[model samples]
Target: MAVFSLMLVVFSLTTGEFVVSGILPDLAAGLGVPLSAAGLLTTAYAAGMIVGGPVVTLLTARVSRKPLIIGLVATSVLANAASAIAPGYAVLLVSRMLAGLVVATFFAVAIATAASTARPGKQASTVGKVVLGLNLGIVLGAPLGTFVGQHLGWRATFWSVAAAAALALLTVLRFVPDRPSATTGPVAGELRVFADRRVQLAIALTAVGNTGVLTVFTYLAPLLTEVGGFPPGAVPVLLLGYGAGAVLGNAVGGRLADRALLPSLAGLLATLVVVLGLAWLGGGHPVATVVSTVLLGALAFAIVPGMQTRVITAAGAAPTLAVAVNASGYQLAAAFAGWLGGQVVDSGAGLRAIYPVAAALTVAGLGIALYSLRRDRRESSAQGSLPGGRSRTS
Candidate 1:
């Protein structure tokens, strides 16, 4: 029940993050902005996450988990409400950013809480379930919010998100146990974990590795309807398929990461590159495009649990702050993706161009993962060696 409530909290908070994707056209029109310009709303929210995660986590390092989470969700409710009532684009943009500010702290706490409850050796699976809330927000909340936006208005979507967040807040208060952090200490102490080359690599790997997926996903609506020739009404249904794929991917990825973390990421990233290319090639065909959509969600999200585990392990004693910083890095990359994708759309390369470029970014991420794996092996080899150049415990 605690984990489930935490998932519900994630659902409400994250719905605000991607709801703009589903209702981009409507929102752009409603706010009297260019479609391209409206894409920045996504960027704005991401930018907030980019700034909020590390900064807020550092500040609240000593706060109890349950209260911190409740406060964060309450902030989300207010931010979404502010978005719903914004008088114009600037106001709405600020509101979105504000809503984003609470995400990383909330997520870090939720993840720690969920992990604390996990049975030994099931960390990845349990983390996957926590991440499932994020998947649910992406797959279910965004589409339903979009459906609501289509029927009522874009503002109505924000209003509805606010209500959902409020309800989740109650569940969080009821169910999320106050699992105190063990490493709660001075900020200066926690900062040293970033000095580890592997830790730095893990954080960069997340930002660089995930950029491609975010790029394609940020522009999915236009790619589906404008390029693939699907009607606007078909989007919500297609998103459901994408959502289904995401859920499956999360489950499978968790199990794989539990068995072998780096190897699993390598496979998933390679598959992601191919799937992204397929999305590009299949852009013009409705059937193929739909297939790519589901595969995209699956491949894109399949890597998350492993990535999270990688950084947390790397950060060691400062896992909470590491998770927050990692999430911020992810949003920083996402903000770049939204900008780069928009540039692709405007550069005469068209929306299809975004996919190929996205594939390239994923390739870079794969390279990073390989390097990190190689380094891990080298360090393990060194540590296992004795002063006399012989094996230790074997």
Candidate 2:
């Protein structure tokens, strides 16, 4: 039931975050705003995630996880409703910002619920299910909302998202179990994961991986339409294919991580670099571009669950803060990638340039993955040297 509730929340949050992109043109026209101004719907959401994740995580650290999730979902539903009925563009922006903050809170609560809901070794699998919601949303929600917007208008998109959020709120209220109170500590305790080397590596890797993908995904529609010469209507199909691939990759990634963490992480990162680079240079051929795009989506998502597992394991007892921080890093990376890619587009480099930059960042991430593996090996070797040989490392 917790998993079911989380899946719904993930679907709603993911849809609400990226749905604006699909209907950007229509939204701009209906609101009588510039396309760039409408883009703030995404930017405001991203900005709110950056601020809300830590703030909410800390402020609600002492609160029960079940109640936190329920409240966040309810807040998200109201915000989406507000967005749907906003009297003007400015009010819509405010609505999105509110929604974004709630989404951030959801991220922390959802992961904690997923992790604690399970027994010790089952942590990764449980949390993976929760994170899977985000992947499903990224893969399904945005495009689905976009398609709905085409016929029903942009306001319908928010209405649908609000409905989803409301459903999630009810599910969480009915299903998720209440957690014990969090330990009382200064707020610094939540931020302490930053001091751990392996934890920092995991966060850095997540940021790098996210930056690589967003740099390309942020401009996907334009690339497919303008560069690949794909029909306008075909964009959603391509996006759906990408989402499907991410779902596949995420499942496979979890299995591999359970056996050997570093090997899984390295393979996914390496595959992403190759696939994204090919996507950069493959734009002239429509089939090849779509294949590479799906591969890019799959490979990037493949890293998410495994990397999250690595963060939790590395942080030991502080897994909650570690997971929350990882969520923040992921959003931060997307914002950075989108901004940097915008610079490339503004300079007349065209959408094709975005993937090549993405490819480069992915390659850099592969390097980070390698360093993390070597560190893991060293830590293992050190544990072997202990007299009792009980394996003190997490």
- Model 1 scores a C-alpha lDDT of 0.87
For residues 1-394, write the lDDT of model 2, one tens digit per residue.
8787897899899999988988999999999999999988889998888888777777777766677777788889999999999989999999999998867667766776677777756665666788788887877787789889999999999999999889888888888888864546676686776798988998898888679788878788888899888999998788888888888887778777776787888888888877877887788898898898788778877787788888878877667667777788889888788789899989898788888888889888889989999988888888989988657754
Q: Which stretches of candidate 1 lie over 4 Å from their true place?
A: 21-41, 85-93, 150-155, 225-232, 281-286, 387-394
Best by TM-score: 2
lDDT of residue 394 for candidate 1: 52
Flag regions of model 2 displaced more than 4 Å. 119-121, 346-350, 390-394
**For candidate 1, what's the RMSD?**
3.1
lDDT of each: 0.87, 0.82
User: Predicted candidate 2: what Cα RMSD to the true structure?
Assistant: 2.3
lDDT of 1 by residue, 182-237 (tens): 35567778788889898899999899999999998878888889988999999778
Give TM per candidate.
Answer: 0.89, 0.92
Task: Provide the lDDT at 356 for model 2.
Answer: 80
- Global Cα RMSD, each model: 3.1, 2.3
